[model samples]
Target chain A: MCQLLALSCAEPTDVSFSLTGFAARGGLTDHHVDGWGVAFYEDRACRVFVDEKPAYRSPVAEFLKSYPIKSRNVVAHIRKATQGGARVENCHPFMRELRGQQWVFAHNGDLQPLGDANEPEHGPYAPVGTTDSEAAFCFIMNRLYAHFAAQAEMHADVDDIDAVFEIIEQATRTLNPYGIFNFVLSNGTAQFAYCSTRLSYVIRHWPFSSARLVDGDLSVDFAERGTPADRTAVIATTPLTDEVWTACEPGDLLMFRSGALLRRAHVPVPDAVLATSKYALSELSAVPA
Target chain B: MCQLLALSCAEPTDVSFSLTGFAARGGLTDHHVDGWGVAFYEDRACRVFVDEKPAYRSPVAEFLKSYPIKSRNVVAHIRKATQGGARVENCHPFMRELRGQQWVFAHNGDLQPLGDANEPEHGPYAPVGTTDSEAAFCFIMNRLYAHFAAQAEMHADVDDIDAVFEIIEQATRTLNPYGIFNFVLSNGTAQFAYCSTRLSYVIRHWPFSSARLVDGDLSVDFAERGTPADRTAVIATTPLTDEVWTACEPGDLLMFRSGALLRRAHVPVPDAVLATSKYALSELSAVPA
Candidate 1:
């Protein structure tokens, strides 16, 4: 398993104080000695650094800690591959450009039962390494491009905001059948998240308090954050379990803009097998609120 | 930007069918081949495969594609190191065990200012690699053990559902100050997910239609497998763009059990800054919903 870290604040702030303990797990204490990467947003642009080295051992990871680059939105990941090859190309926190905006993404799961490659209308981007994660990313971007292009033919305002949301919603569901798809993606403007099988979230608001990492000795006081109006949210495969976390039900999709929930869509649960032997456990399963 | 895939079904199903196209992107069709791995959940146990070669070139990845392993829960990942060393150890979808159950995690971001490593109090479980991801995993287990022990001291009900949830929640938030912490975690029975900056999700039901991968040309028809009684959910970094995906707010943590939402908690957000600085862009800022 891998680890992911991110921060979205009312104002850009350095992640130093918080990252201290988290970084130690990479190599100094943890087994994800694989490569790691981080990305921070700066005025509609992202400043990112990726390396095929553990965050603890990598001089670059250290430089980042000291450099203290600040951003309102940040995405990060440490790799533990389950598919493909291990190389720089497979490093996470991958970046892509869409409509002149840089989009960042990282993943922590694998899709088995791989299918044959389909030719992109454009020439193949070609894999640098052999990780299925990167390939999936490319496929997503390529499909998004195609979807946007297809939509552009009918709608001039691709960012009509409403259309973008509707379109994105449709796209996400289409990919669900492929396999477990757990990812974090960001455009300089906002961060989008989804939950399928194994995901959890916590929305931290004004009433902040001191929190410490169970993984390391680092701690942070929300009181030090200056403004109590700041709203920060953290999401993960498993609830970090250090604070109160909420679990999303299957088929629920949510949207976030500026560290707040904007919209949500709940995929309907089919009733075909409510009382059948196939879903007997599910029928008896009562979600603990 | 990287790709993530997972499979959590009522029964075991091979992921290689879907993995083929995903793997091609790294070396064949795309470029994410740093390393590759896949896991199959058989009852409570998971059978996994990891290779350092490009999936397109690796005989192992090929073998898995044709293999039909099945399980109720599975997690997989590919690598694209952004930080840390790119050795065999630094792969995605790391696995561990605690309290007699196997736990797996994968990440797609980087952590800066990594703190000192803190091994789980349970034992000498240490990271083999240097990525912050693994360190985080060990930390979680340690915290769980500590929580359980603390409960034992109070003579609390070890089986108390609320107790388990509370401990997990606290552990998650504790990791935040470190950096962007987004991940997918599973204990073979339940899955946990979170979003720190960017993530999204989508869920599917019985009427599994033929789906075409946006990244590749292959298509799968779910109608052939079973009736419309099946239901599943998916979470990812970005909405798949071609499917119906939901976005998670910056700091929303959620939990999932048996493919359903179990609970939720919102972390506190910081205060909002008055727009005194000229840096504020009136056109881009949108009020959160």
Candidate 2:
């Protein structure tokens, strides 16, 4: 397992505090010491910084902690090397170009039947690395390509983003039988998050207050950096700050845009996992959307 | 127009020295101050550093000068916008994935008939930014995909790289009439460069000596950082150091791998440019490869 963090905001906001706390888990506070990566989206394009070195000690990570590169959508990950070696290619937050948009994806959990020599069946998209996370990302890209291949010239016509989210939901549900499929994906238009085992999120709006980091001694008052109309949604594998964070129930798929919840759907519990974590589920599957 | 620089080495080598001199052009010595970007390849993957700010004054560019990140294949570009606005998305050294390899490209000249909104017909590839350079790159990628999409399994069987080079050559020839289209492309396996207006290259091998930067007041001895077996081939829009560099004839396409020249082919001169620079061509078209 690893750590995942994502942020969606109404306005482009710097994520220095969140990244500093999250990077500590790569080598300082916790043991996800394999590699780390982050993608910051700006106007359909993205700037990705990845390091095979443990994030806590990486020079790039150190630089990013102080550099305030603002972005509306950002995805970050710290890996523990569950599937592949500690090579730069195996780092998380894999990216691809589709429909004239730079799409980013990162997985926090391991998947089975991957990390082998043989690649899973995919179209147009292929994994450049050997990790299950990259393979899973490519699988989602392939699914999206297949869904829109029949469309006309305007492939970027993802005006109805919910329809795109549904495809991502189905894609995650299809890979549920493989193993933990918790992941975060984005294409600057929206942020999609799927939780199979563990995930949490917090939204900060107008009345922002100070919050202390759970892993470090640093604290920041959101009011100092945000305006009355600003809104920001932060998602992570575990709560990073001493603020109220709603724990995402297993099999929950959440979508956010402009720092607000766009949609929420409870995934249908797979038959294979029905017996193992039954007690973990108090509500029935397909609760609401 | 923009400035482009690329390196292909027998072993992983840090490009800090070259980057220092080249980055100076972004704001210090020259006027390519719109933005800058560089992609450093690490085993089939790459780390890209880009800044919308002037490279001479950017913090990221400052950090890179001191950092010794190494790579076997590297592509860098500093842009002066002509087709697109100075946004992060319009920065050069664009990247895409093809055949499970991270393909990178950087353009150094403006192209005509591509700035308008009507996108050229392409395959699965698309441009994320409104730049003629990226559109030209997508056109090349479409041609390559059209040539190889018919292969059965094993799409990565690019053993016949010459055939791949031929496709790129033809693609360049097809777009030759547009305007200046100098570019450098790589997938870690090999480096391909095409010159339509201006390009130059120099190879440093055994018994390496010192050289001074033409754009800066710095000098370095290659023997201090290289072994006898180390061979570094550098291609740039202009020679960064005061070393002997071979000027590439217009319409020349060069392929290199492991720091050694593989092949070179001169594209047939386009009828549009035949009248303007006929005196420049001393050799016939289709030069020895």
Top TM-score: which candidate number?
2
**CA lDDT, every prediction?**
0.58, 0.82
Docking class of 2: medium
Question: What DockQ does model 2 achieve?
Answer: 0.55
Predicted complexes: DockQ each: 0.01, 0.55
Cα lDDT, model 2, residue B38: 93
Worst 10 residues of 1 chain B by lDDT: B269-278
What lDDT would candidate 2 get against the real structure? 0.82
Candidate 1 residue A195 C-alpha distance from true site, Å: 2.1
Which runs of model 1 end up more than 4 angstroms from their true locations? A27-29, A113-118, A122-128, A153-158, A239-241, A266-289, B1-289
lDDT of 1 by residue, B17-83 (tens): 4566557654564455677666555554444455556667876666556555555666666665656
Clashes of 1: 216
Residues A222-241, model 2: lDDT tens digits: 88877987889999988888
